[model samples]
Target: MIGIATFLYIYGYKYICKAILTAKVMFMNNLNAPFPLLQSNKVKFISSFSFGFFVFVFLYIFQPFGINEVQFYKPLFIGGYALITFSCVAFSFFGLPLLFKNTFNPDKWTVKKAALYTSFIILIISVGNWYYTATIGQEVISLKHSFLKFIGITFSVGIFPTVIFLIFTEKTLRKVNESKAGNITKQIHTDLEIEEEKQENDIIPQIDFLADNNSIPLNQLNFLCIKSEGNYLEVFFFIDGKLNKSVIRYPLKKAFEQVNELNNIHHCHRSFIANFDQIEKVSGNARNYELHLRNLTFTIPVSRGFSKDLIAIYK
Candidate 1:
């Protein structure tokens, strides 16, 4: 009996801890079930053991199945039988998650998986119970006559309880998902309102450019510069702490007019427009007056005609 208890305690300790962590993340993350110590394996094992022990005690003391429950004679003495029964019940509850981990996996849960898991656990428990009764209880079993009797007894213990638990679990999960969806929608709306308020108070302007069916909104302060590429213009800007660009089919001369209202912007070259306030350094003279801008890796060419205007803005 001690050997059975020790074997159960050791193996149950190993399997239950890992099983609880996986089940909590997979099956209970958003649902927020009230088992706080599910995150700790030691606590989970103790909880399972204690609860299982109490339930077995209640059933044993009351003898719910009466004296001749299955073809087995009543244990004229239950002290030894009660201890073994408690060990089995505790082991069953502690190791249950390990048995059905795949069924509760967050990414792939379904009604089919739940039903399959229920069947597998029931089959295993039935076989286990048959062995326990044959070995430890006062039940004499013959290969010929007791096989069907064992099946009938084990089936009664395993099936209905599992089906009831599965039904309650599925209904609870459906309600949690619906509630979470409503909260997520409200959060998105609140974020959009906050962003609009910040844009209104910003010192630099926000530019809205129509880019193929999408509207790309660029903050003026983070707008590095733009360079004309034949019929297209490559617009550079800083967003999410990264330098990014978009190629749009707009004429450079026409693009300049759209942004001319901004005081710090200047047409520094026939091919380039510079945001003067963003310039970190200006080098070279007349022929090659290169302009280096903050947060930009490359320099912009300052043509002879635009050199004086760019230099004046830089100083």
Candidate 2:
């Protein structure tokens, strides 16, 4: 009978662990929405209460401790037992996990931390059992022996469930990461398709660039940088992962007129035109400003007049 009672107690909490942990995984994998209760700490307390209620009801029905044992179904005794056990389990679940919040992160999980957490849980359950037994007039013959028994019983209750929770948490996290990666890959493909469609429909009017004997293809993604050289302009662009430069004999105004059709490119100064999307950094005050563009060795000056427009664009 004692063996059956011990088996049932440990087995009951193991079932509870699976129920609550499975619910947690389902909440995480839910595509539409998550349950509100699971979002808050109340779920922990509620889960504990439910498991306590189930165990108490099972014990009530079976009376497994034997007919010689004291009545457990009496209103006062049962209510007090329910209060103590539920509060202990609820506090253990609701509070202890949070105490190691920084350590509990799955990415950096350590065996040392997990062992410590397990030990703490066992201690809590053991103390809770000791308190319950004391309240029921169970006299301590030897304090150390009673403590050892409580530790052993609580260990049996805690170990298997802890293992289940950790395993489920690891598996759930892996599936979530895989799902995220798949979604990200699909999104990237969609974005590329949209941009390709836009390029096909869009057209650039030909501006005779006489600098390096090359015409600027406004549709291309990688146009490096442009600079003013005396009255002529230097148009530096990229092709096939290589840098190409052309000196346009025309003034900056003519180049701006041609490049203005592209939204990502901006005319920032009388001597400079920049692809705003490629800019790495912007520096300087009202008197003098500079735009540092990515993948380019040089920086472009930002004229005082264009500063307000740049600010407005960002805002």
Best-matching candidate per TM-score: 2
lDDT of 2 by residue, 199-297 (tens): 777763333333345656643366655788897788877668777777767778767777766556777877788877555555552133467666778
Clashing residue pair totals per candidate (backbone < 3 A): 0, 4
Candidate 2 CA-lDDT value: 0.58
In model 2, the runs with Cα more than 4 Å from the true position are 1-43, 50-68, 72-85, 97-101, 104-107, 137-145, 160-164, 167-179, 195-315
TM-score of each: 0.36, 0.39
Pull out the clashing pairs in model 1.
Answer: none
Q: For model 2, how many clashes?
A: 4
- Whole-model alpha-carbon lDDT for candidate 1: 0.57
Model 1 Cα lDDT, one tens digit per residue, 176-243: 43344344334434644665588677676666755455465655567788899898889888888888
lDDT of each: 0.57, 0.58
